[model samples]
Target: MIRFAVVDDHMIVHDGLQAMASRADDLEFVGAAETPDDALALLEETRPDVLVLDLRLNGESSTELCATVRRRHPDVIVLVFSAYGNTELLTQAIRAGAAGYVLKDTNTGRMPEILRELVRAGSYFDPRIAGSLLLTSISNPSEPVSFSERELAIIRLIARGANNHDIGEALNVSPHTVKFHVSTMFKRHGVHRRAELVRLAMDLQLLD
Candidate 1:
């Protein structure tokens, strides 16, 4: 069984999800929490294979919470559930190391399959959100956003608003090389300016 811990404020959502997991032969509804603090405490005590996290829990900031969980328990995989499926929020969660995101309309029937895939393979994508992600990819096919591993590292630094000279010093490369990488990133991301590329990289979760 794929052990799971749920973090959601709504009792109904919690109960319903528990019931659904109980009905699945391969899923174990190990525990549930209504807040980030409680969830953290629970996770420290019992390490679940998957954390079914509600993106908006009462008034808590789920993005920071997700990042914190990842830092504290790097082994626990997080599957975020959101009511809005906001692109910014989804991207932010992914950048913080969430393994998946599912909108509230996600099909319950496929929940078991998704959990299985996550447990066995360490990944899962909610179909509805996958469609949105695919649309983004297709629409931006010519966006000039391809990044090599080295370029990706540079972009992450750029995302921190690092100056070319500072970035070069930190990365142990010449300033000219950093400038070239930045210029290439701008060209590939289809942006005319450095700030735009920074925003785009963050949006694409190419930089945290």
Candidate 2:
């Protein structure tokens, strides 16, 4: 069995990934964490074969944590399971030594194959991610995500049940900025309510 651990701030995200990972025979959900510190502690003791991680973890830097995991436990493969899909952070993650970057928006059904491929093929990146290192010179499978990186970040927080004020505090930005992003996102979706934003995110696979 390929030992696996998933880390994210929300319990729902953790439970969802776990459920998806459970369907495969080779993958085992050995551990989970709600914060970076919790994940690091689990990593030190368990020595899992792979880690499914999130980008935002209650004020901690998931990118830095990925680097540390690579440096400290060279054997554990890190696969980022985040909502943020930006070129810079993705590039930084590969440099930090992550095995792959799979957006939470992608079909959760494919994750088992991805985990297996990471261990067998040494690395993997989501085909649906633009500028993904895993893709070749020919065709790009990902639709060009139009929103700016900051907008993407706020969208994720909103999907995770965070209100405007909560999102602003989490991102260390002003509530006005959060409202701006939220409104822009809604307008882009041609939506007039928060519920519609959630619906669009789900329908478009913008969030898992």
Candidate 3:
């Protein structure tokens, strides 16, 4: 069974998701929270395999929350379920470790199947934004960056907005190791902040 948790401030969303999960034989509704902190606590207790999160949680940035969950519970997959379809937010969520992006207007009845596909494939994007993502990917040059394979891997995660801790967990390395690589990359690229590094990566087409 696919254990699932939800984080959304809307009671209706919670109720709707609960009903949908209950109807699915392969899905188990673990819990729900209206805030990121509460969601983190619930995740700790339930250890759900997947978390359906709202992009806006009482004004809190969901991208940061997604990164937090990924850092704390590396095993859990986060699927962003939001009403907003802004490309910036969608990109940010993916970079922050979300495994999928689904619109709130999407048929809740189909969410169980969507979540199943997400877990099986490791990632998914709402069809609305798929074309935008494809265009963005196509716009990026195909030239490779002048870095070692490990460094390139780190750069890709960095471009995805991952912190040292998140990158460490994803790559199965120590945070210190991630930090060392990040610092080296910083010196090589003459950039100090994570945002700068991400911009540089984009300009150089270092992330495919």
Off by over 4 Å in 3: 140-208
Give residue 82's lDDT in candidate 2 (0 to 100).
61
| Model 3 Cα lDDT, one tens digit per residue, 1-208 | 9999999999999999999988989999999999888998999899999999998777556778899999999999999997655455566788899999998889877898899999999987898776665665577656333567798888788777788899999999999999998898776444567665555554334566
What's each prediction's TM-score?
A: 0.64, 0.63, 0.66
- In model 2, the Cα lDDT at residue 64 comes to 83
In terms of TM-score, which candidate is stronger, 1 or 3? 3
lDDT, candidate 1, 1-208, per-residue tens: 7888999999988888888898988888888999888999989877998899987776444877888888999989998887644444565678778988877777777788877887788877666556665676688765543467777777777668788888888889999999888787654444567665555555455664
Q: Please, what are the lDDT tens digits per residue for candidate 2 over residues 171-205?
A: 99999988988888765444567755554454344
Give the least accurate 10-residue stretch of model 2, judged by summed lDDT: 131-140
Model 2 regions lying over 4 Å from their true place: 130-208
Could you tell me which residue pairs clash in candidate 1? 144-188, 144-189, 145-188
Using TM-score as the measure, what is the rank order of every candidate, best first?
3, 1, 2
TM-score of 2: 0.63
Highest-TM-score candidate: 3
lDDT, residue 118, candidate 1: 78
